[model samples]
Structures are given as structure tokens and as C-alpha cells.
Target: MHTTQTFRHVSYLWDEAKALELAGNEVDLFIYRSNLLGADLRLTNYAGGNTSVKITETDPLTGQPVEVMWVKGSGGDIGTLTKAGCANLYVDRLKALKNRYRGLEFEDEMVELFNHCLFDPKCAAPSIDTPLHGLLPYKHIDHLHPDALIAIAASKDGETIMKEIWGDQLAWIPWQRPGFDLGLQLEKAVTDNPNLRGIILGGHGLFTWGSTSYESYINTLEVIEQASEYLNANYGKKRAVFGGQKLENTDAETRKARAAELIPTLRGLASSYRRMLGHFTDDARVLEFVNSNDLDKLAPLGTSCPDHFLRTKIRPLVLEPADTLILKSAEELKTYLVEQFEAYRADYAAYYERCKHDNSPAMRDPNPVVILWPQVGMFTFSKDKQTARVASEFYINAINVMKGAEAVSEYVGLPEQEAFDIEYWLLEEAKLQRMPKPKSLSGRIAFVTGGTGGIGKAICEVLLQNGACVVAADRDRLDDVQTELRRQYGKDSTITAAIDVTSTDVIAESLKQSALQFGGVDIVVNCAGLSISKPLADHTEKDWDILQDVLVKGQFLVTQKAVEILRKQKLDGDIVNIASKNALFAGPNNVGYGTAKAAQLHMSRLLAAELGPEKIRVNTVNPDAVLRGSKIWESGWAEGRAKAYGIAMEDLPAHYAKRTLLNEEILPEDIAKAVLVFVDGSLGKSTGNVLNVDGGVAVAFVR
Candidate 1:
């Protein structure tokens, strides 16, 4: 509640026209749109930050030069800003002295300052720190909480913590209130250190200002880049042991039991918040954290940043129940409210009174944002769609950071009252009611073979959006696939396994591990088949064996093993085989591949016949010319096959395209979706059928 405010002159202000001129000539947004040479710059180079410019114009009525500030609004990362994201504010009004502030209360001053603000009236409230940006004297200013700054801020004793690493080059400040106070503090710090390149606010973020917007933005990134490099080199080993321990314990039964208990609570929370959130409970981090011994200690540590309190309450409700019933959970929450808050009932009433506006409904029940049951895990609550999503993201990120911190040291979170203060802050509360609408397939599960391949990877993304847990398996040990999947789907929702599909043992193990991790598997898309382009005369015994093993034998092995679990669970499961157009029509030098694919087609028919009684459908998707960037293309299979057929590889694709009525290059994903149709139960009674996903390549040819 300290209320001292200060301002500084940047000493290099430019007019609006000059600002626009600078933006047009040097901003990457203009460059990217103009198809200019700098478009290839890394997209993240300037993300999660903002740039602003000040324009002074004479008000026709007032006879005064009114300074209007144009600042980048929220939602976009600064590195990727375009023209539309810049918000225009009444700068002169923003910088105006408080009318009755000579002896005004803090709350009154805040109310008055907020009332006169005229920026992005339609959007959620302008950033809470708008006052900080207004007071900077520079025409253009840039700010970023880059990963490097977060790394330093996240550490214990971050000021002394950073000094050991950054030397004396970087300036540091203790954490403080972000708006008028932060701006004033920064002004003083800069004055004290006139040559200061940047300021790092311990536990808050980083700020870099300059004569122009671009220089400030670039310098912020450069400073963060240096910090990142230093951190990577110096303190990177801090969590190595913890990470290793977590990984080593991944498959332990104790971990699984803990995970199972947590999943139901998470699922209940997700289901309750279904309208507002995307797929939330299925993320791997949630799964992993719930199963850990430190979940109770970990959950709160991972909550959203100070800004996230409005969307999610300060801390999720931790339901350490002796029983698993919802009634018990409710009782536990009530008890916790009393135990945790000295004047729980009064505070709840006061909170509602403060937040309720003229027509706004009474605040929803004072349930916790998330709940952690004893053996059952955690649950998150939201009255509507947007709050749920915000809660979910906040929870996920918080848990991840906490888990990460726990690896290096004990993760003691911010005091509960402080968290409450931030969560109830007016600016943050608005975000809680603005959660994103839920997505389709918000909590389904999918298993994909060849997920490391481009086509398979694309399909995985589509399934993820539709709310499916994805298990991506590949024959190669490309850990990059796992890393990328985790990046997109959260570690829990995506599981990667290395398996040679031809080996029944490997397939069985992979299936077992997946079932154990995700309760059960619902959809299976078989994309593990391979082909060898070799003429009938030149086809070696070894080549034929390899082709038959992967394309034919492997398919049978995987399907047979998964069938038992699918049937036992009574899940009307679907299986889609990636067949080849060559299975229907001959392609020169594809003697071994074509024969194996034909065998796979026949096998799909036989499996359909056998499994139909159990309501487990089987089908095949035959695709042609899906060789782009695949092993087939990279290894010159299409070129070799075309050469044997006295044609060019480029012409080979066209020849197949013309054979098909649509004349399109059949992508591997096209085949995957056709397989998905059967897996998704779209083909109700259409088991054992071969769906041509080859863009009509097989239409002209008769069996």
C-alpha cells in the first residue's frame, strides 16, 4: 500500500510520424508481411514482450498538445507483433497527476487513476502495469519477462543469486508492486546506475528501454540470450539429480497408484469445467505430479504467476480426504476453509461484495480452484468456460515450475494471504470469467504408429486438438519426437515408445505400458508399414524378408496383441492399416512391397471377419504418392521405382495422380484419417473394407 510515484525523462523522444517511420523500416512485422529478407528470423526471438510509442497531437478543442501512447496489447508475444495488436491510449491522461491525491487514501487514488484510463475499453482491462509504461519518457519502450530473467527470478536469493552469474553488468531490484510504484523504483535505479543496460526485477521480470522500440526489444532479447547462456553453463546441473530420480521412478507401481488416485480428481475437475477449458487433465505433467510423493507440497508452488490469481483463486483446494466420495470432498473443502482462514466466512462474503458490480451475479460458490484428494489426486473448479481454461493452464504451469524447483531445492511457495491478495486483485478476477470455450474430443485417447514421421506427427496434432491422449510410437529412437509431443500435449497426454513392430514382444510391451498409463486405449492407427522398391528379378531374399516383416507380419502382431485388451474392455475399438495403392494395382520394382501390402489387406479382411463378433472393427487405407519427405522419398524409392518403370520420379507422382480422378498428391495423413474414420466408429458396419485414400489412384484399375 506504499504510494510514492516517480517519473524519468528518456531524453530521446520522437514524434508519432517518426515512430511510424521506424516501425515500418525496421520492425520484423513489416518485414515478414512485406516478404522481405528478415522474415526467416526465429519467431521466438521477440515473443512474450511488447513495444510502445508515444504520439503528441494538438487537441483541437482543448488547445493543448495531447500525448497518445500506442502500446502493444496482451495475448501476443512481442517478438511476433503485427499492426493490429498495438493499442492506443490517452497518454496525456495516463500521465496526469491525481486530482485529489495530495492527501488521498491508496484505494481512492487507485480508483481515481483507473477511472480516467482510456485504453482498449472493449478488451479485458489494460495490463495492470500500464502506469509504469506511461511514466517512461522514451517515445518507444519495450519490456519482456524472457526465460532468462525467469530463470534468475525463480532462484532463491535471486539478487545475490544473479550477481554470482551476471557479474556487475546487470542491475537488479527487489520484487515490488508493478504499476506506479515499479515505474518509480525503476526510475531511481536507473538514475543511480546511469550506464545500466537493463533492470532485472527479482521475482517479477525484466525491463529494457531505449531511444526507439526496435532497439529496446532487440536489446532485451540479447540480454536475455546472454543470461540464458550463462545459466545453461553455470547452474544447469542443479536439477540433474532430481530429473534423473523422477525419470527412474516413472514406471514404479507406487507412482502409478498415486497417479491413479489423482487422475479421478483431475478428471472430475476437468469435467466440471468442461465448458470453459480445453483438454486439461490429460496433460502428462498433471499425471506425473499427482503420482509424486510431493504432490501436496508441489501443487500450490506451481500455480499461475501473480497475474493469474483472478482467473484461479490463490491456491487450489487440497482435498486430503480419507474417502473418495464427492460429498466427502465438499465436507473437506468446508473444513479446510475454516482451518486455513481465520475469518473464512467473513472473507468469503467480503470478497463477493467487492467483486460484484451493478448487474453481475453473485460470485460462484467459494470452492477452491483445484482440489487434491488423499489417494485420489487433485480437482480444479471453474463456474464457466474461460475460468476453467485459465485455471487449468495456471495449474499446469505452476505444477511444472514447482516440480522443476523441487528438483533443485525445496519449493516453498508464496504465503497464502499474498497469493489470495493477487488472486482477488480486480484486474486478475476479470480474466477468470473469460475462459476459452472447450474443444472437441477434449479427453479422448489415440495411439499412433510412426508418429515421428511428418504425416503421423500432423495427425497426432489433429487428434490432440480434438482432445485425445496420444501415444506416439516409432521404430527409431528419435527422442525428439517425444520432446516435441510433450511440448505440444504436456508430458502426460503424450507418451512415446520405441518398438520394432515386427517383434510381437515389443508390441505387447508397448501396449501394456500404454494401458497402464492412460487407464485404457481407445483409438489405434497403424502407420508402421514399410515398402522396398525392387524389381521381381533383383529382389533379394533379405529385402523380401524385411518387407514382409514390417508391412505384413508387424501389422498382424500389433493388432493381435491389442485386440485382447480392446475386447476385454468392451471398447468398440477401431484399427486402421496403412495399405498401399500398389496393393490394388501393380507398380514396377515394387514386387516385394506390393505383395506384403496385399497380404496386409487380406489380413485386415480376415481380422474384420474374426473381430466383428466382438464389435471390434478393422479396415485398411490405401494411399499412393505419399512419399514426400518420407523414407521412401529420402531413400530414392520412388525415383528407383520410376527408373525401373522407365519414368521420372516427378512424373511418377503425376502418373499416379492422373490415374486418380482428383489428381492430388495423396499425403500420408490422408491415409491416417481414413484409418481414423474406422477407429472413430464412422464406418459402423464397414469392417474388413479397404478405403482408398489414394486420391482415386485405384478407381480406374479393376481387381
Candidate 2:
């Protein structure tokens, strides 16, 4: 064991903070180093860990020096820890708040007291574990659920093994749900072992403290390094023992094709609930673990630590190996995935029933947070993409921990009751309760062709408003569209691409970029079209070609590329083509535009029938007179149509509106909504259908 430790003095990260005089040198140094600790995924992941420093400052109210602990505040990641992310709490008040607990059964009451103990009302909510940090007598404290240390601490003989590894230098505290009682217990343990440098909370995480921020941070790394070395020596170096069989003739494209054939069934099953969203990953180590023959035995052992249960649940939903899937046909494969999901849900319900005690909260949604597919790797499900990504990271880390622990002994996870306690613990439950209700199409990604145009931009806006990340693609002027979309939906949620929908190469590249940014698209809106109103005899071949390329050919190429991405993601998808009412009702000198739209209508029906087996639905929306806000009307098309009617350009919109039986002015927003009715899957069993947005255009009604 490389346990002989050396302390290194870390350099200043906030040299500018001292120069700017933004904060005291000590406070700024603490903030800078805390971010470094948070950035290391091996140490702690995605806001799951926290750091704190004790500082004495004169109280403005009392003109007396008081000790305050500046801890990482709630809902803040340590990787981006700012001075504002630290919650300044009075240590004496926090200690006094503990005496008022009175052994309350409900956890929220204790959380309320922690809030009252905060010295600065402007400070963000302190971490729930603030009490534990406060009770320990140290100038600086760091707490992390580092995977290496957690693997050793999460096993059945974790305390015994930790003692043998570190001797009396490290103290062991048995598993306790994080709250007031746990804080009191930790305080007692520290008092009993006055000379201890750090402590390990069984099935939870590790804690290290020192007289300065650098000392505490380096101490954390050294102990984690030692734990890694210990595991490597005892359990075989570099996870060599857990290597598994790799698929023959399998490459990245092959895996993606297999996913398209396999994942839609899983996605279909998961998306049966409006709240569930799915994500797929073929990350190298995850693929190896899922392909391993021993996965059946090891996968169900649960998360590496108790903290992870809130994110991943106790165990993942595991399917049969990829080799088994390869032998089945597409239909057979889908049936098999559905059966596995059904079995997983039933098993989850049974586990919840068994784990429930009288005082325990109701069982969670019973959906597996992580789904382990054999050859295809893993699919993680959550309410949205951000949560799914976080859960995915946690599960991957858990796999690493399990592999290391397996090398030492048969790895053990926390028992059923304890897992339930943490999963339903009020602090964790509060986090979920704080989340806003998801929008109807939340977690779904949509791609809109001609997205810079009036109706197309409206479609993109509606989708973003309903919580879908949008990729807005257009042939030109995309930078302006990008600005509007970013202003409305945030830069992270909106992507803009310049592409000619008529070109397959450009379409493919744009779809690829969309997938790279936001997983894969669930909805494809084909809104790129053009109008060339001319009499059949007088219309030039160039007029016919231009209209066909922008409408018929453009819609075809964009839909084909989107379908490829949708199939690869193996998720339910919608393709809504915006066809004009001119397809249903012929008007004078409209042959070129009408013929192209009519061809699009028939194409939608044909594609719908072909793609339905893959669970991809195709539909069309027709609008008669959306002249009020359509770029198609503003850009010379309306003027040409008015000339055919022998009317002024200003009278065109009113003339078209009056032609409708209801005399309602159709806006681009109206057409966008009509497309959404089919795209959002609200009409679950309806497809190959045309929805009309022109208010009472009886002539344009489907014949």
C-alpha cells in the first residue's frame, strides 16, 4: 500500500481576486481550490459533494468576532463554485439548533432549523450536511463521494477493511441517513477519536479536514490516491479482472444500427409515461461491462454507495446480452425488449412493496433510472436530458466502484430498507419536489426545416415553449434566426444550422450536428416550401423546377435524413410536412405550386405506411390563407397572387380571409399548432392524415 503520504502546498488560483480586492485572500483562495476539487469527476461528480471553510470575522451587529462556516450552498456545483455559492452560517447557532431537534420523525422540520441557523439571510441555502461539517473541529473540511474510496466504504466489511488499510489515522462512522441525528452521531465520533485526521461514513462518502484549504484539498487527493492504489494492488491493476468478451465484426456504425433496431422498443415502452425520457450510451467501459458474462451476477448488487441510490435507484434494469439479441429478428427483438421492461417494472413494484415500512414515503415512479442493454450498452431514463446525463455519469462511476470491490471480495450494496430510506429521505425528496412540472413535450428534441421562415419559426417557438430542445435549419439568414431562438429558448437549448434542404449531403450533416448537440431528434417538421403561381401553358420549366426543389424534393431529403437519426436513436418520432390547401382546391394560375404540394401529400401517406412498423409516424398540415405572418406571402409570392386576382397587394390577405366561411384571418401560429397536434403524439393512433388550419375553408377541406 502506498500509504506513506506527502503533503504538497498548492499554488494560488485567485491571484486576480487579491488584485481586484473582491474578497479576503483566505476566502478567495478557498473558493478557487474548491472549484478544482469539484472539477475532478474521479473525486466527486456533478454537485454531489461539498466543501467548507471556517473563518472568524467581526460581526457588524455585535462588533464581536464570530466563527462562521462558509459551505458550498445548495444547488451549486463545486466545479463552478463562486464566492456567492458559499453559505455563511454561524457555527454556534447551528450547534444550538441541534438541541431543538427533539427526535422529530419528519425530516423537513430539522431542515427548517438548519435554515434558521444561517447567519446571512442573503446566503443561499446551506448544504444539508452542513451540520456534520459544523460539529467537526477543523479549520477546513472537504466531503466527497469519490468512487475509489466509496467502493471500499460501500462493501459489507467496509469498516473492517478500512481499519486494516489505514489503521487509527482514519475513523469509521456507520451508515446514517444524513440529517440531525447523523450530525450528532458524527460529532460524538470525532470527540471520541480526537486525533483522527479524517473519517469514512460507511456506504456514504469520505471526509478530510486540515488547518488550511490547500491542506484539506491535498489530504483528500492523497487518501483517494491511497485507496486507488490499495484497490489496484489487491484487486488486479487497471480493472484487468473485469474484462469481457467483445462482439466480433462490431464497429461504431454497426452498434448504432443495432441501437436503431433495439432501442425504439425500449424508448416506446419508457415514453408510455409522459414524464419519462430515455438516453443511450456506448461509452467504452460501459459497453465492456454490459457485454461481460458476469454482468448478471454483478449488475444487481446495486449502487456503489447510498448517495447514488437517489440518482440510479438500487439496481439498473438489465436485459439479456447482445449475442442473445443478435439471433432475433427485428420484430422478435422488439418483443423481447418489451418483455424485459415489463418484467423490470413488476420486479421494481415488488421490491418497493417489500422495502416499505409504516413511516416510509410512497414508492417512487418504479421506472428504472438506468437500463443495461447487452450488446447495445446502456440506456438511462429520467424526466429530462440534464437529469438523464447526471444519472448516466453516476451509474458509470458505480460500475467502476463495483469492479474494484469485486476484485477484493464479492461486492456488497446497502440492504433494501436502507436504500429506501435514502431514496425517500426528505432532503433528497425535497430536491425532486423543487423541480418544476415538465412541459408536454419536455425532453424531446425537434428539428425544423426552413426554420427561419415565418411558419417554420413559429413551429420552432412552440416546440421550445413546450420544453423541447430545437435545431432550427434554414438555407440562408440562419444567424438572425439563431439570435431570436437563443433569446427565447436559451443558447444551450437552441441550435441553428445553414443547409439547403434540397441537398442530401447538407441535410445529413445538419442532422448529425443536431444529434451531437442534443442526443437525437424526436420530431421533424418539413416546413420548407415555395410558391410559383403561373398558368400551366405559360409556366416555364424553371418555375416548375424551383417549386419542386424547394417543396417536394426538399421535404423528401430532410425527412429521409431525420428518419435515419430517429431510427438510430430507436425512439418514437413524428414527421409533419406543411402542405398548402392549394393541394386540395385548385385555383387559377397555381398549377406549379399546387402540383408540388399534391405530390408531397401523397408522399406523406406512402411514408407513413412504410415507417409505421418502426413506430415513426408521418403526417401533414394544410393551411389555406396564413398571409398575415407568412414570409412566403411577404416575399413576392403574395404580390404575384394579387396580380392574378387583379387586386391590390394590401387587399390580398382580407380577400383570402373573406373567402373562408368563418372570415377568420389565419396566422402562421395557427398552422404551427395544427402541425403540433399530430407531432406531439396527442393523436396517438392517427397518422397518414392531414390537419387543416384555415378557419372554415370548406373548399380546402379533405375530399
Candidate 3:
């Protein structure tokens, strides 16, 4: 093991005053310690480390203090973990399970036996690492996959290197899949050396501990900082890193532009089995490695640590496009990737065949989760935005591990069969099986213009609830709405951006953000519009041009630009234009708004016809008299309509409802619901169609 407070590479974020405040509260302090360790990726990747503290708790039945271990639960990230996410188990019971441990093969049964040791029934389920912490004698324990430690852990002479760094204070152990047996090994290794600070798990990660939570936290960072300093020194001594850079860096703008163009196609190919969202980055570290001569050689050898290997797959697919970040054409690009994907699947199948045990789960999706293009940055794909981002981050960690290992010593990855076994582990398969069923719009991405407005916000919320990631685009950014939605639906669910729909350049930038933000747009809602209720006599050229520019030309430009990405993805898509009932029904003092809406309605049909052959669906939802919670209504359109009808402004809802065949009041949510029907796959076969949400207005019914 490598153990310090002073460091150059890692941050010392511990708050002494806060620590003093939490001193008496062990569990909260433990959580604080865990959060600090997880806050920095250098300590561990997201969802990649486990921390624990053992404390005496009053036994409900006996009224006696009993030793209980609190550890991070399965499927929880340490950075965001709370008390609710911790599993509490009787330490004595966990230790007693050793008698029932039949053998190494029977370690599979230990996970089930963990239930017998639960100290709290409602606590989150214990992770497989529970025993790792519970079995140790220390009051606090932290097992982390820090990049600097991993770099040494991944080297061929990792154990010898550990001895060189910490000599007698820290210990070393060979690689073993974590479970009861590995936990036992940890306990014995520490038991044999009472003064040891920690142990290095070869080709895996580091294990550090202390008699106190704060001590454990500091020890973990000290070890990482020492290793980081060592690696930095060695890297400085090297003539070059990663056998020297082989490719030149592309300019940021060209690289980003090319990344956006290819991301949709990359997403299309990655969605070979099921759709996966993508994340792209050109972080300095990522650029350095991808542009290295060793990238092709090191990439195929795969990630060394099990956590890194699990998320990124054993190895990433390396694509050799032109050094300029340009491909010959879309057709050729697809053909080349199709072949590459097929080859990757075959390789994965062969790996599974060679490593399967009698009870191995059937092979998972064989497509590569991480892709490397030399001049371009890395692309990572998964079922959601956060996961994709984490995967990419993990790959970058892997890259750093390789860089460190190669800079000082030869890098090593897990044995192919070992990686396969871990990937297909029956326990992992069960965890995956326990995951909740995907929501209706799961794996779908959406772009909503005017998304901060009442109707648009409702649509974004509904889509988020149904599992779609959304990009909320408006003429100006809605900072509060974005922050609130991210807080509610998770940071991955939606992003907010300002866009001018009338400018092709702005619309193009919006689509680029969409591609980068959430792979590509799967659905688009043209809901940004303002109403000018004026008669032909009152309507001026400015009124007509502004109305046409925003309502008609704006929707056209947004759709036209977004379609380029939709086509590149080669995936089914939907566009919902929010036309009004005024487009169909003649009303006094509504010429500008009605005429522009009519043009918008026809444009949907026109786009549907043009894009239908590419599996893109364009539709319109005509919402009439949505007086409540509508921006247009709030912006005087309601007062204008009330005056034209000779009624009170507040009475517009009743007036419009009375005019409807069903005497029903229309609302922004009703319009939002109408938009959902078009994109939720329930009406997959119906496109180039109009759905009138006017509470049964006879004149506005679509033909």
C-alpha cells in the first residue's frame, strides 16, 4: 500500500471545522469522508469505490451496544451516497459466515448469506464489498480505484513497486475477484502485519484503513498522492510518454464540428442492439493518449482494473479514420462501421465462448461501449447521458493508467479469461436482472424549443418522467428552469440552451448541442411562438413578417437543421409543431397569428412527406384556447381575444370551453399530452397527421 496530507497532484478538501462539527457523529463523518474521496476522480471514478465505518449500535431487543458495519450499498455512487444508501450489518454475523464458506467456488453463495447478517432491514442491500470492510479489524476502511494507484497496480511489477514505495508499511496481494474469499485474504494480510497502513490489490485498486474515519480518509489520499508524485517524477524522466505522440492535435473548432457530425452516425452504429446515448470529450489527457503511438496497441489490451473493464468493456474499438477527422462520405462511413461492428461482435462472442462457466449469463450486447478515433476525441455510449459520461471518464482513467504504467514500467491488463468471467459473473447478471424495467421513452432524446414556457415545461417533464433525456431550447436560456429540472429529474435528464429558430446558424448550433448533449435528437417540439391577435385592417407588414419569421420560418429553420442530425443517426424520429386552432377557424382580429400558424401546420405535412422515407415522423398538435399557464396568453393574447369576444379577460377559459362541442377547458398540460402521443411510439404508424386538442372544436378537426 502507498499512505499523507501534503500533495501536489491531488486536492486536500477536508474541512477541519466541519470535521470537528461531525466528530461525535461517526456515520455522518464516515459519509463525509467517503464523499470527499469520491469528489475527485483521481481518487476513484464515479460509482467505483466503496467506504465503510464500524460503530456500536444499540440492539433493539437486548438494549446493548452491538458492533455494526455501515458500508456503501450496491449500485450507489460514493460521491452522492447518503445514509439511506448505506447497508448496516452485524459485524459478528458477517465474521461468523466464514464457517459456512464452503470454498472458493461457494463464494457465490456468500452474497445470499449477507442477508442473514443485516442489522437494519430497511437499509440498502449490501454490496459485494461489504465483507471487505466488515472482515477488517480497522474502525474505518476505504477501498478505492484511484488513477495514480491503478497506474502502479496495473504495472507488471506492481507488487515489487509497492515494496519500493512504502516498503514495510504497506502490503501487496495478487488480483482476485472481490467476494468473501478475497475479504478473508484481506483480513489475514492485515492480521499478519498489525502496523501496516494498507494493501495494494494487484491489477485492481488500493485498500487503506485507519483507527478513525478522518485518519482513513487522509491515509487514502496520502497513498494516492505519493504514488501520483512517483509517477509524475518517472514520467518527467521519460524521453516521451506513450511511446511519443503519433498524431497531431486538430484545432478545437474543427475537432468539435467533426465530432458533432460523426456523433450521430457513431450513435447509429452503437445502437446496433438497442439505442445508447453518447458523450464526447477532448480532455487534455484523452487527447494526449488518443494521439499517442501506443494507443492502438494499448487499447486492444483493455483496461486493467475490473471496475474500469466492466463499464468500458474489456477493450475499446479503435477506428482509424483520416488524421484530418474527416471521412469519405456518409455511405462509406456507415459501411466501414457496420463491418467494424460485426467484427467486434464476433470477437466478443469468441471471448465469451472461451471463458464461459456452466452458469455464466448469456453473452451481453457485443457492441463496443468505448470508441477511439485518433484525431477526434473519445466517444462513449450507454443507456443514459450520465452513464455515457461516466464510461468516457472511466476510459480516460484507463488511458492514464496505461500512460503511467508505460511511462515507468510495462502496463498489464487482466487475463482475457478473467475479464470474461467477471463480465459474465452470475452475481452481476442477477443485479442487472433486478434493474427496473425501462420507461416508455427510455433511450430517446428530445429537443424542445420554448421549453421554459408552461406547455413546453410540461412536455419536458412528461418526457423526463417517461425516461427521455431532453434539451430545452428557447430564445434565451432559462437558468432557473434548467437547475430545477436537473434537481428533480437528475442531471442527465435535461439541459437548457438559448437559440434563435429563425437563424439556420443558430438552429444548427442547437442541433450540435443536442448531438453533444444527448447523442442526437430523437424528437423535436416546435413549441416556440408568440401570438399577435390583430385583424387584417390593424395588421401591418411588421406584424406579418415578425409572425412569419418566428412561427413559420422559425419552425422551418429549426426542423431543417435538426433533420440533418436525425438523418445522420439513421434512427426513427418525430417532430411536433404546436399550431393553433386559429389556423383552421376564422376569428376576428387574428389574421397574423392564424396565417402564420396555418403556414406552420402545412410545413409539418411537407416535412413529413420529405422525411418519411428516412423513418422520420413529422406531426402537428393544434391546441386551442389554452388560457391557463400559457406564455402567449400571459403576454396579452388572452386579453386581445377577450376584448374581441366582448368578455372579461379572466372569462376566456369559460368562453372557449362553452364554444367547444364538449364544453371542456383546454390547458397547457393538454397540449403537452397531445405532443406526447406523437413521439411516445404509441402512434408510431401515424405521421403527417394533425391531432387537435381543442376540446372538440368542430371547425379545427384535421381532415
Q: Pick the candidate with the highest lDDT.
A: 3
CA lDDT scores, all candidates in order: 0.57, 0.78, 0.88
User: How do the residues 538-611 of candidate 3 rate in per-residue lDDT, one tens digit apiece?
Assistant: 88899899999999999988988888888888889999999988878888998889889889989889989998
Cα lDDT tens digits, model 2, 487-556, are: 8777656778878877898887787656545556789999987787777787999999988998999988
TM-score of each: 0.51, 0.79, 0.97
RMSD of each predicted structure: 11.7, 5.7, 2.2
lDDT string for model 1 (145-257, tens) is: 44345545655656765676566666887655455666666767767777767777765566766665545544554565566555545433664422322212233454444
lDDT of 1 at 621: 79
Candidate 1: TM-score? 0.51
Off by over 4 Å in 1: 1-65, 70-72, 76-86, 95-125, 131-305, 308-447, 451-499, 503-523, 532-544, 556-575, 581-595, 598-619, 625-630, 633-690, 695-703
As a whole number from 0 to 100, the lDDT of residue 181 in candidate 2 is: 78
Model 2, residue 621: what's the lDDT? 92
Cand. 3 Cα-lDDT? 0.88
**Candidate 3: regions farther than 4 A off:** 1-5, 321-327
Clash counts for all predictions: 22, 1, 1
